[model samples]
Target chain A: MDDLHSPDPTEQSWGSLLRTNREEVLEKWTQTAAANLGGRMTPAEMGRDVDEIYSALVRADTGDQIDIRSAAYADLRSLLTELSRTRARQGFSPTETAVGVYALKDAVLEILEAHGDLPGYRAFARLSRIVDDLGMFMLETYATTREAVIAEQAEALLELSTPVVKLWDGIVALPLVGTLDSARTQVVMEALLQTLVDTGSEHAIIDITGVPAVDTQVAQHLLKTVQAARLLGAECIISGIRPQIAQTVVALGIEFGDIHTKASLADAILLAMRRSGLDVVKSR
Target chain B: MDRIPILRIGDVLLVSIQIDLQDQTALALQDDLSSKIVETGAKGVLIDISALEIVDSFIGRMISTTAAVSRVLDAETVVVGMQPAVAITLVELGLTLDGVRTALDVDRGLALLSSALGKAGSDVEVDDLAHE
Candidate 1:
C-alpha cells in the first residue's frame, strides 16, 4: 500500500521533490498576489519573491509527523488586496495591475508547497477563485477610464473656432489657417452660408494659402458647399492658388475648368468686380 | 452630427462639414445652405475642405449639384483648402468633379466675390448712363 503521509523515494529524491513542490507553490502564490495587488508588481520583483519563497519552503522539513498547513493563504490574500487597493488609488495601468494579481498567486503557491500532502487542497482552490476575481475587476476599471479620455479629447476639438471678414458690398472672405475635418467643415459651411444670407452678399471668396493640403473628401465638401450656395442665388470665387495646390490638382486629375479660379484674392476681386460692373478705380 | 456654425468671413459663410455629404448630411446641408443663402442673401459660398480626407463619387456629384443650385439662386460656389496629396489620390482613384470653383485660399476667394460685386455696381452705372 502507498503511504500518503511520507515522501516516496522512487517518485523523487527528497531534495528534488521539495524543490519542485516549492516552485509550484511559489508560482501559484505569485499569480495570486499579482491579481490581488491589482497586478501592479513587475515581473522582476515577482521573480525575486518566488525565489525567496522557494528557498524558504525547501529549507523547512518536518518529515512525516509535522502538519505544515497554516492559514498563511488567507493572510497572503488580505495583504495582496491592500496592495491592489493602493495601486488602484495611484492609477496604475492594466499591465501593472496584472502584475499585482500574479504576486498573490505566487504567495498562494508557497503555502501549497508547505502543505504538499495536506487535505487542505480544497481551501487553496477557493483562494484561486478570489485571485481571478481581482484580476477581472482591475481590467474592467482600466477600460472605462481609457474610453473617457478619448471622448473628452473629441469634445474639445469640436469647440475650436476662427475669425473671418466680410465686405460691405456682399462678398465674404474666409481665410483658412489650420487643419480641417468633417466636423469643422460642417461648422464652416453653416457659418459662411448664414453670413451670406445675413449680409445679402452675392459673392464669396475662399483663400487657402494657409491650408497645408487637400484630400478627396475635403475637395468634395467644397464642391457641395458651392452647389448649396447656388440654390440661394450666391456665387463662390476661389483664390490663392499656391503652386503646390495647382500641381496637386493636376496630378489628381480633378478638372476645375468650369469653376472660376484665380491666382490670388486680388484677381478674384477683379473678376467679381467685373461681373458686378463696378470699377475699383471709380469706387475708391 | 447636427449642422453648426463654425465661422463667418465677410458675406461668405465658412462651415465645417461632418457627416457624409453623399448620405443624409448632403440633403440637410443643401436645405440649410439654401435657407441661409436666402436669409443672408449671400453673394457667395466657400466650402472648406481642410477637414475632409476622402471624397467619394457621390460627394463629388453632390458638390457639382450644389454649384448648379447655387447658380440658379444667383450665388456662386467656391471650394477651398484642397490638399495636394488628396487631389492626387482622388484623380488616381478616377474621381472627377465638374462645375465647382476651387480656391487655394479664402482671401483670394473673397476677392473674387468682391470684384463680382464691383462689376454688378458698374453694370448698374452703365444702365443709368444708358437711361440718361
Candidate 2:
C-alpha cells in the first residue's frame, strides 16, 4: 500500500496526527459510530463512549511507547474495560461494542484524506493495525469482564438463595428457592452451618417449596446437607415435599432415614418451634 | 512415645489434641484413646481439637475411628472446639465423621456428654433390649 500512496515523515506520523487532531478524529469517529452502531442509542451516548476510547487511543499513540502492554496504554485498557462493562450491562451485542472501535476506520480514513497529509498506505496500514488491535481489545475485554460480572452475580444469587432466617430463638429457617446444584449446595450448607453456630440454633427447617422437582441427585445433595447439619448437632427437617415429590421419593426408594419430613413450611416451622421447646401462643 | 494423652476428668475422658497429628501419632492416639475408654469405663468421651489448625482425611479418619471405638466401649463421643475453617475443610474433604457428635466449645461438649450419657443410661438399655 506504501507504493499506492505518498510517503509521510515517520512510521508513527499517523499516530501523532491522530493525537494532535483528536477532536477531528473523535468528531468523525462519533458520526461513523452513531450511524452504524448506534442501534437504539442516542448520538450523545455514542459520543460519551467514543470520546473515552478516542482520548485513550490518542494518549496511547502520542506517548513515546505505543505498545499493547505499555504503561501508556493503561488508561486505554481501563477505558476499554469501562466501555465493555457498560456495553454488557446495557445488553449491547458483542459486535456492537466492538463496532464502537471498528467503525472508526472509515472516519480516520476520511480524516486522513481531508488533512491532505494522509500517511501512505504503509503508515495507514500501521494505523489500521493499531485500530484493529484496539477493536479486538474491546471484544476480549468485554468477554473477560462479562465473565467476572457473571461470577459476581452468581455469588450474589448463591447468597440470596440460601438465606438462613432465624424463625425463633434457637430455631433457624433456610427457605431454599431454586434448582439445587453442587455449588449452590455448598453455599447452602455453609450458610446454614454458620447461621446455626451464630444463633446456637438446634433445628433447621430446609423448606423447598420453591424447588420445582426432586430427583435422585437433588435427594443426595439434600442428604449430604442434612448429614452435615446433624454432625453439627442440628437436626434438619425436609419440608415442602409436595405429593408428587413424595411419590417420586417412594418410586426411587430413597430413604430419608430418620431425618424428619414435613408437608409444608408451616408444619416445619411449628415442629421446629415445638422441638426447640417453644410454644406458639396467641398474644392479647 | 508420641501417644496422645487421655485425661479422665470424673467419669468423662477428655483428649485435647494440641499438635498436628502425624499419621503415626493419629494411629497411636486412636489405640490409646480406645483402651482408655474401656479401662476408665467413662460414660462420655470429649475430643477437643481447638488447637488444631488443620485436618486431613487421615486426621479425620482417626477422629471417626476413635468415636466408633468409644461407641463399642459404650461411651458417647463429642468432638468440640473445631475452628470454623477446620469444620469447613472437614466437610469439603468429604469427611462428615457421621458417628461423632460436635459442639462449639469444650464446656458445651461436656454438657452434651452428660445429657447424652444420661440418655444412654436409660435409652441405651432399651436399644440393647430391643436388639436382644
Candidate whose DockQ is highest: 2
lDDT of 2 by residue, B19-128 (tens): 98889999888888878877888888999887887888888878888888888888888988766556667776788887688876687688777766655454354233
Output the lDDT of residue B96, model 1.
Answer: 39
Tell me the interface RMSD of model 1, in angstroms.
12.3
What is the total number of backbone clashes in candidate 2?
0
lDDT of 1 at B95: 46
The CA lDDT at B84 in model 2 is 51
lDDT of 1 at A53: 38
lDDT computed for candidate 1: 0.58
The 0-to-1 C-alpha lDDT of every candidate, in the order given, reads: 0.58, 0.77
lDDT of 2 by residue, A1-284 (tens): 22212243434455655666678778888888888764578899899988877777766764334366677788888888788888887777888888888877887788667764534344566778777887788898888878888999998998788878988887888888999999998888888887877777768899988889898889988988877676666778889999999999999989988778899988888777655442111110
Residue pair clashes in candidate 2: none
